[model samples]
Target chain A: MASDDTPAIRLAGLRKRYGTGDAAVDALKGVDMTVHAGEVVGLIGPSGSGKTTLLKCLGAVIEPTGGRMELAGEAIYDAERGGWQVGDLRALRRDRIGFVFQAPYLIPFLDVTDNVALLPMLAGVANGAARKRALALLTALDVAHRAGAQVSQLSGGEQQRVAIARALANRAPVILADEPTAPLDSERALTVVRILNEMAVQYRTAIIVVTHDEKIIPTFRRIYHIRDGVTHEEAGEGRPV
Target chain B: MAGVYRGMVDDGQVLIDNSGADLWVVQQGTLGPYAEPSSIRDDVWRGIAGIHGVAETGNAAYLTMQIKQGGHEARVMVVGIEVDRPGRPGAPPYLTFGRPILQGHYEAIADEKTGLKLGERVRIRRHEYVVVGLTRRMVSSSGDPMIFVPLKDAQEIQFLKDNDALINERARTAANPAFNRPGVPGLLEAAQASATQARNVNAVLVRLAPDVDPDTVAGEIRRWKRLTAYTRAQMEDILVAKLIATSAKQIGMFLVILSVVTAAIVAFIIYTMTLAKVREIAVLKLIGAKNRTIAAMILQQALGLGLIGFLVGRVAAGLWGPAFPKYVLLVPGDALRGFAIVMAICALASLVAIRAALRIDPAEAIGG
Candidate 1:
């Protein structure tokens, strides 16, 4: 642990199942981990290895079978209350969480600025204010020059970065990246990892990158590996490369 | 209702009298009363002209019933007007063929609907009259042909009798003989009076000056009680609302039902479309987008589809309006109202799809 302060995320006994009886399939089995703020961690697993299930539970995208998960010193999952939030979980995610995916699924109709601004606007921020915030983030992310461009016009890397800017638009304290560099070249993949690391340190964000990308695995000092619904923790070579 | 009667109006441009005045002064509650057997006294125009502001008046007769003209028999509204003074109000706004009844004696004008060619001779009630001119689209309110005839001849045709019936009536009077005075020439007076009165007609037609208030004189005519009169505006209202009110109501009900049906169709379509994109919607849901945002996007798209359909329908209806039989009156206001209703229906219809979209679980995108 880097500091005595509470970690940005704490998880214990996380489990997931699709159905009951003989057809049941357990995806996550009692996983436990802790990641402090300003750290970029990797979740590596093979196909069908519960990596996606864990990410979903972390993002509030799905309910866990049984778990105690906390975010930013707040209890998020209690199997007793059913891992679902009592009210609008969507609002919780929009204000406090961010997500990055394998492909950049930007809204084709809106420009890059608007794509980033859309979340804040949905959260009651005025259009102008939201755009200003989005512009600042895009400038920080190096995609500000292409603010006016439509999503279709951006190159793959630019799109990926724009999507990253969109993810950080609300300045969420946590980000969950799933195979974000899968479609990029080797250089682009490392560039994306470097950008994720810089963003985590700059924003004091806790980022969880789920990947099968072996090239970037050694870059994370802390890595969690899971196989057949069970996870094991390991420390990687503590080097930026 | 007028859509059903569009055939006749499409074919006519003829107005019986171009210089006719403002008021039609029909029977108080009638307009082209073409579906019923109705008539007023021939001399009704004399009193109407005597009214203040009534610039000129003339006798006009209208009979709407089954009439045999040429070799064909169909329901026609026969309007008899004098060649001078005021033109008949029921004359159509357009003329596609020959001129209106601007000719002198023995002239007749027929709607293209009646299939009467120019200069054709037709016999009505045994009175031979020449169709000197052809006219287009002179339709009665009930969607029937309006045949313009010379006033005197129309009166005579309407009044003309069979010789045997007239002779029989004469025989009955002669046989009645109260005094049986030989020098009295028994049947002569009764027969002559009956013959003379038979040619006298049903009602008068009056046209007032443009600036005159027709309602005032119309009120005066109503006071006479024996005669009834209607102004031009009143006549159009009566024709549209009163005369065709029942059919209009029927069509209105159909339109309402069609709108509801269309709304249901739209809702189902939007729902189906949303369901097809369930995974996509789930992804959007998981990404922290609010339900209202997703709902609005679907609603806007549904409205866009409605707007497109309406434009296509309006254009289709307009292009096909002319080829219909009878009269199809596609009023501008009706189209505007239709557009408004379409929009409302689209909005209401989108609600179903929105609800379905909102219900999608965000976890579906993850799918354990």
Candidate 2:
């Protein structure tokens, strides 16, 4: 069980290698990071800097060659085991982590409410209860009016908001956003960042936003810059949105 | 004669020809080849007449022969009946033109399909007969037109050898030296006279008393007369089951091939539909949807398509069944069985698409 003082996510000496022998290429080398509850952090790097690889390792989509990772208060990966400690990585991902991608890839056949409620349903929640939870999150995200609309009928901004609502539907402790605001205008980009901040504080969730977008970089109070498979932490200007 | 024996009238009962007889008796194991002539000694008619339930009995001869008409040979079934009355047991059920064959020889009644007009002459077995009447739908089991001739003429056509063959047979017998001895003068003539006589009939047709059951009469004849008698139901079985067994097997093979083709087409369609949604599948997996959930969706879609196709096919078959040249029976039980097979095929066909959907990697949804 997680305690109040436990960090939402922690990583130390996380390392990943692509292959073995002479052809092997190390993607991550001795990276360390931590994000507490109720905080949102930024990860920015150039191409081939291992940002995506590290995010994948943190999300448990890929295994780290050597590392220690803690989610909430539970130990998920250990360097000695050389793998994840969770019995089922898929269930671990569904119950403990959320993801928002560059494009809002909502299921085309499902309506907005069902698109958001699907996560809870997969986690063994009843259909009606899942929909209620989805409606509540949609109301908080200000997209409740389009709850019954198809994903294709919504505007670009509306679709991204629905994706955010889906990410928060399961009340997961951590969310990894991969260039989520990349396709938005500056105003919409800042609006997405502000919503992320509000959601992080209200739900006590830890969020890591990975991006190369210069327009929204200043909104983060702390940013980690990666160069050559290594991360260096620095303080952002923390400009208000 | 075969067609008349098996035809269903408007009231759904088997049509009885002018033959007021209810049942037919033939030699054992000879019912299958009804058109081929078989001799029963001509005296069996007396034994059949003595049966307890028999009201009347008549002897008939059947032969399939080629008749010369307008420089062409037409295959026909020549039937022989005792024309003593207007509506005898072996006469055509109804006539459309001219009149029945009142004389016992040299007169004929032909089916309309034979193209024989009233008062026209046709040659059969070195004898010219005048067609006196025309009938409709009077055909043999193989759809050959029937030509009704008198009892004695039909017997000669069925049993008498050609002139040359008969002369050769008599010469061979005389050369044997067993019947040509000097003391046996009448023995040789007696043998020749017996050879020239035509005294056999193919079957005996019997009419039962009003209150007697045909099965009971058939049993009695079989027990006492040492011959085979067939009731109406038994005759129907012989015509439908035995005669058409090969055709039924051919149709069964065609149905199997059609089902296989339908399954392959369904599988291809479902596989293509799944491929179109590959991106959506990745997204679904990344959002933590289970494999079974995706599989069930594809299965349901396949079954829905099959249901629509089956309903349309059934309606089309029903609309066109009556117009077929032969009888096409579309029973409810066959339709239900077809429905079950369609659903099973759809379920099996969706497996290919389900397997493809399950193999989609969730990492593809989150590009690096």
Candidate 3:
């Protein structure tokens, strides 16, 4: 288990460039950031400010042109981990990281319970056991009554919560939420932020919430605003609505 | 035994049939639906009853003709049976709707495939017979409706012509220079009338005793050398394997084409549906859903769609098959085989969509 003092994610001197020569365009110049356990941090940046690019690198979705990435005290990508000899990068992504998108992209055919249970089931857990864990999480989130309901039947906020439950289903140490509150009202956005904080504290998980929403901006005590692929850290307002 | 029996009867040694069995004795060289055509004494059942185990027998008839319906003329075989008398071998095994002919002159029984309603009338060989009864799955060698009529009526249709043609024929014969000279023109008409009445039958039906072996009786009939006989089992085999064999193959070919078309349609539908969810799939990948899991989901959906489609197609085939002029027999075993085939096609169809989804990059979801 990763403790609160241990950093769940670390990026050092990260750089990413698309194409080469005349068509070359650098997406990430150099990024340095550390998100420790039990901390829900905001990533605030303008559109195309390399916020997505940096997030991709930090999430290990895209390989960096140059840098080191460490998650949960293990160095996943470095000067040495980068050689062309590795057999699989997909397996690495599946086992280590979790993601929550801007929209609650629940599978429509599945019910609310199975939508959250799907991640654990994908990890080879038995269906009954995965569903059991899903129900437990749903109960904790106070949405257990809707477990049998189809995902299409759930409201937007409820659907986002189900998506969040899905992100945490595998019990990964790090969660990257991409504009998770983008479609919500101010109260719902703050509710999601508060939920993320409680989940991080309870699960000892590190969370990075990438957003441009101002309503929940002050809820995060720590913030990383990126520009031109460079990130600068600042203490958030820490104000309660 | 039929030849020997016939010999004894010709020699005035025995009475009608004392043997009891259910059988179809056809023409020499013509097995049931085969090459030869057989004619028997119309009242042979009376003799057949005197044998050993005949409960009862009836004259069942079959011949090919062209029927005009819905403005399209199609060549079809007309199977005539006596439905007025129940418990006869020639009667339909079951009735679907309406009453049996039961001694009605113009009433007839028609298979559902002939597009005849229970109360409809059909013109067979210039005689309008009312369809008072209906049967199911009763077809001839060439997939035609077996129309059950009274033995007398079927005989009329088989041999008798219209009043004008009969009169013309009698006049032509009466005008024959060798027979008439000049004294009697209508005199020959009376003689031709008697000749027309002697039209007997094309086959003999033998119903055997329950315990008696039909194989032995068939062998006996063949020994008579002047006739042919078909046991029940042999008749069914001839009907399904030889008579309808080519037709079965034709429908089988249609089945193959339909299977392929179904597979292609399912693949296209599933592939298109999957493409619509590319972003969701990529996000799923980035969020750590396994490739196999996603593949299984797509596969299951394809299979589910095929299952529903198969149900609809089968029900549609059944509901509308009777409207066709030719017989369309949808057997239960055929339905089961079709279901298995549909599932296999569905499984194969999903592979294309699965491969497409597997190739989606998780990075795409993150960057966009």
Q: Count the clashes in each prediction.
A: 19, 1, 30
Give candidate 3 misplaced runs (Cα > 4 Å).
A1-4, A81-95, A124-129, A139-142, B1-23, B31-153, B181-197, B207-225, B310-335
TM-score of 2: 0.68
True contacts kept of 2: 0.45
How far does residue A231 in candidate 2 sit from its true spot (Å)? 2.3
Worst 10 residues of 1 chain B by lDDT: B7-16
Q: Which lDDT values do the candidates have, in the order given?
A: 0.75, 0.82, 0.74
* Residue-wise C-alpha lDDT for candidate 3, range B1-368, written one tens digit per residue: 11222222221111011111257666667764332366666776565555555546667556778877556665655655655456566666668998777774677877776777877767877678888878766655444556777777777777667788878877777767755656756656566777568356666667777787877776766665345777766765665466445655666677788789889999999999999988889878887777887898898999899899989988887787656444355667767877888999999999999999999988777644
Residue-by-residue lDDT tens digits, candidate 1, B10-122? 22212223314355544445443332344666666777777787777766666666767666687877777776632454343445666666655566777788877887877
The residue-by-residue lDDT of candidate 2 on A68-144, one tens digit each, is: 89899688999787577889887887888888888888888789999999999999999999999999999999999
For candidate 1, the TM-score is: 0.71
Best-fitting candidate, scored by DockQ: 3
Q: Each candidate's DockQ score against the native complex?
A: 0.40, 0.40, 0.48
RMSD of each: 6.7, 7.7, 8.1
DockQ of 1: 0.40
- What range of 10 consecutive residues in model 2 chain B has the weakest lDDT sum? B2-11
